[model samples]
Target: MELAIVGLGRMGGNMVKRLLRDGHRVVAYNRSPEPVREAEAAGAIGAYSLEEVVERLSSPRVVWLMVPAGEPTEQMVERFAALLGSGDILIDGGNSYWKDSVRRAEWLRERGIQFL
Candidate 1:
């Protein structure tokens, strides 16, 4: 599957690498340019912005977030929700509280975006 991963920290970056190894198309983005450049060198497409990430993916886009918990994750989800269309999926791989995750899932679901 084609996926866009935001926040190229250790976990996220490794996810991109593993996905590439499995022959999946990955678009990687980071707040810092270095991680993104590194991911690009490792065969992942580099996206500088959330809009670019969305633009790079095909329909029924899948975007994974690896940002920090609480405010950071919330902000990223909100930003991606605005960019992604109905039928798109957002996966959060951070250490967010379960309640927050539930809330986010419901919110995204209401907007026609799947959350996991």
Candidate 2:
């Protein structure tokens, strides 16, 4: 499947590599340009910004967000909701509180985006 991974930390970075090795097309983004370039070098498509990440993939886009829980996750989900269209999937792979996850899912649903 075509995937967009947001966050270039250990989990996200390793996931991109594993997915690419398994023949999936991956569009990877990170706060730092260095890791983006590194993922590009590792055969993953690197996106400099969230907009770029969305543009690189076809809908319905599947984005895996591996950021920390709480504020960062909320902020990224908000940003992604704005960037992604209806039917796009946002997978928050962080260890977020269940209530917050439920809230985030509801928020995304109101915007026509799907969260997991």
Candidate 3:
């Protein structure tokens, strides 16, 4: 599947590498840009922003977010919700509380996006 990965920290970076090795088309984004470039060097596409990442893929896009919880996750999800349309999937792989996840999922659903 086509994948867009936001927040290229250790987990996100390694996931990009593994996905590429497994023959998946991966578009990687990072706040710092360095890791995005690194992932690009490793055969993944580099996306500087969420919009760019979404634009680079087809419908029913799957984006994995690997940022910290609280403000960062909230901000990212809000921004991403604007960029994503119906049927798109957003995966938060952070250490967020279950309640936050439930809330986020409902929020995304209200905006016609899917959360996992």
**Of 2 and 3, the candidate ranking higher by TM-score:** 2
Candidate 2 per-residue lDDT, tens place, 17-70, comes to 999999999999999899999999999998999999999999999999999999
Look at candidate 3 and give me any clashing residue pairs: none
Order of the predicted models by lDDT, top scorer first: 1, 2, 3
Q: Which stretches of candidate 2 lie above 4 Å from their native place?
A: none
User: Could you give candidate 3's per-residue lDDT for residues 1-116 as a string of tens digits?
Assistant: 79898988888889999999999999999988889889989999989877899999888899899999988998999999999999999999898899999999999999889999
Per-model TM-score, in order, reads 0.97, 0.98, 0.97
Candidate 2 displacement at residue 64 in angstroms: 0.5
TM-score of 2: 0.98
- Estimate every model's Cα lDDT from 0 to 1: 0.94, 0.94, 0.91
What is the Å distance of residue 8 in model 2 from its true position? 0.9
Query: Which 10 residues in a row give candidate 1 its minimum summed lDDT?
Result: 77-86
Write the candidate numbers in order of decreasing TM-score.
2, 1, 3
Off by over 4 Å in 1: none
Which pairs clash (backbone N, Cα, C closer than 3 Å) in model 2? none
Task: Tell me how far the alpha carbon of residue 75 in candidate 1 is from the true structure, in angstroms, after superposition.
Answer: 0.4
